[model samples]
Target: MMHRQRGVGLVEVLVAVLLLSVAVLGFSALQIRAVSATDESLVRTKSMTLVRNLSEVMRAYPEAYVTVSGTTFVTAAASDAGAVPTIQAVISGSATNTVKVDSDDISITGTDSCLSTGIKTVDDKKVAKQACSINQLAARDALMVKKIATDEDIKVNVTTCPGTTTQAIQTQMCVITAWNSTKAILDDDDEKACADSNGIYKSGSQCLISEAY
Candidate 1:
């Protein structure tokens, strides 16, 4: 029999430690990726919810988006129309195309007046609760969008659907949402761009486009 084997060799102990460290590092990387994916999915869900709310409001007040000579939809003539202004963009990359509603304008009192206090009846000599105009309703709708976007910390861009022109009043509208992420930003000429000049989305971008008729 040999005199006796030492408890363990230094080389063997160092190799075991190295192997454990490698395994731990690999697991850590996987955990990080999972967390990132989960976060992105949550943001996408929030974006979808915002789009749904906006679509419902638009459908409820169809007259708010008046058709101009059976062609394009235009806002009615009203002072509050300026509150929900839309900037027509020739290209999808135009920064001005993005319309962010001012959260500061959100006030229950301000909207209450727009809802039920404006027209006074001379015959009754009392303030009659008048129905909100299409313009006022539209302004309210925009504010709702602003509130949601602010809460979600995202950006929204509303425009006519891609490959379709505003020449037709019935053209589908697109609600595009984007947030800060590791993925590529919305741009042109890049394979990873979120949206092209036509407002169509590509893979690998952190953006979601929802279309509503």
Candidate 2:
């Protein structure tokens, strides 16, 4: 009888340890999820702020920032031409207006006349600072985007909201933003939520889509 009691006590100890181990594992998983959620929240906030900044800048300089050329929207980079960060926007309406932003746009070399110290020598050898041209101001804003986007692969797209008719696409612009994250947040089947045939955001994408009128 004594031996049987001892065996039962030992079994109880083992079972208790097993239960504790399971509990610890569950707690660890919860902690990981919490951290992931927090990080994603931060990313979303940053992305929204960045996209809004760009949208506001575009609005401020509508004529220079983007011009509707036939069926496409286009702009040029005149400041910090070497910077490589680019943003693409599409105006979807009667025609798909594609905007391709890259270094191929106009690059202003030599002293930037937009600066206070920039002086251009005219034909009469007179030197004076000139106000920033509309294109130059737009380029400066683009350069700002390039600088802010450093260290992260950021992509922006302007599209019609899902399920919205093409006719209304011109009035509403959906600014979709995505950047790099530690791990993939997109499910294998849900790639279309953040990306499409136009382009793909970086792997481990944290994406946010904001609509602007």
Candidate 3:
């Protein structure tokens, strides 16, 4: 009778082990889903910030955006055109642009573009905040975005169609901004509204759309 009781105890232990294994597997799956959701949220937030930042930059400096047809400024680090650190966007008049992401320089912008104009002041006040170069503002904005985005691909697109901006000088610029975070999980049709059929990247990355002139 003692031997029979020992065998029954062993069977009970085996059943408990099997149940524990199943519970662990279920917990692991839930953990994975939570992590993936967090990643998606982070990617979307960062990407949207970049888009809004760029639009504000352009709206603040209308002159620079028009002249950005061939200006290739460094978008990362404290580097200029020739002093570029590694690689960055080559700003142009094209509709689409690609920029590398970095999260190491948050306070890289906010420099007064009109910081050197003591040429002639009012009664005695120094006219330092006169007018900053358009290119300078654009560069500052791009750098801020680079710092916000870490190891992500940011795509910017400007659409000036079906709109009109009557300018005293230069062509009309009814500009619109559309940006995409390629690293995020998005539907294929999300970016469709921003580009033509040929411009699509075919990657299902949700696009946060905004418009500014």
TM-score of each: 0.66, 0.58, 0.51
lDDT for 41 (candidate 2): 84
CA error at residue 213 for candidate 2, angstroms: 3.4
**Residue 26 lDDT in candidate 2:** 100
What CA root-mean-square deviation does each model show from the true structure? 7.2, 9.1, 10.0
TM-score of 3: 0.51
Compose the digit string of candidate 1's lDDT tens values, residues 1-213: 233655557679999999999999999999999999999899989988887887776566544433122112245432333212221111112221122222112133353334554567777776646554554455456555655676678776666666774422235767677777522234567775568867667766688877776
lDDT for each residue of candidate 2 in 99-158, tens digit (9 for 90 to 100): 223322322233332546657778968575555555455555655554454434555555
Ranking by TM-score: 1, 2, 3
Weakest ten-residue segment in model 2 by summed lDDT: 90-99
Highest lDDT scorer: 1
Q: lDDT rank, highest first?
A: 1, 2, 3
Compute the lDDT of residue 76 as modeled in candidate 1: 42
The local distance difference test score of model 3 is: 0.43
Per-residue lDDT for 36 in model 2? Answer: 87
Against the correct fold, how does model 1 do in TM-score?
A: 0.66
TM-score of 2: 0.58
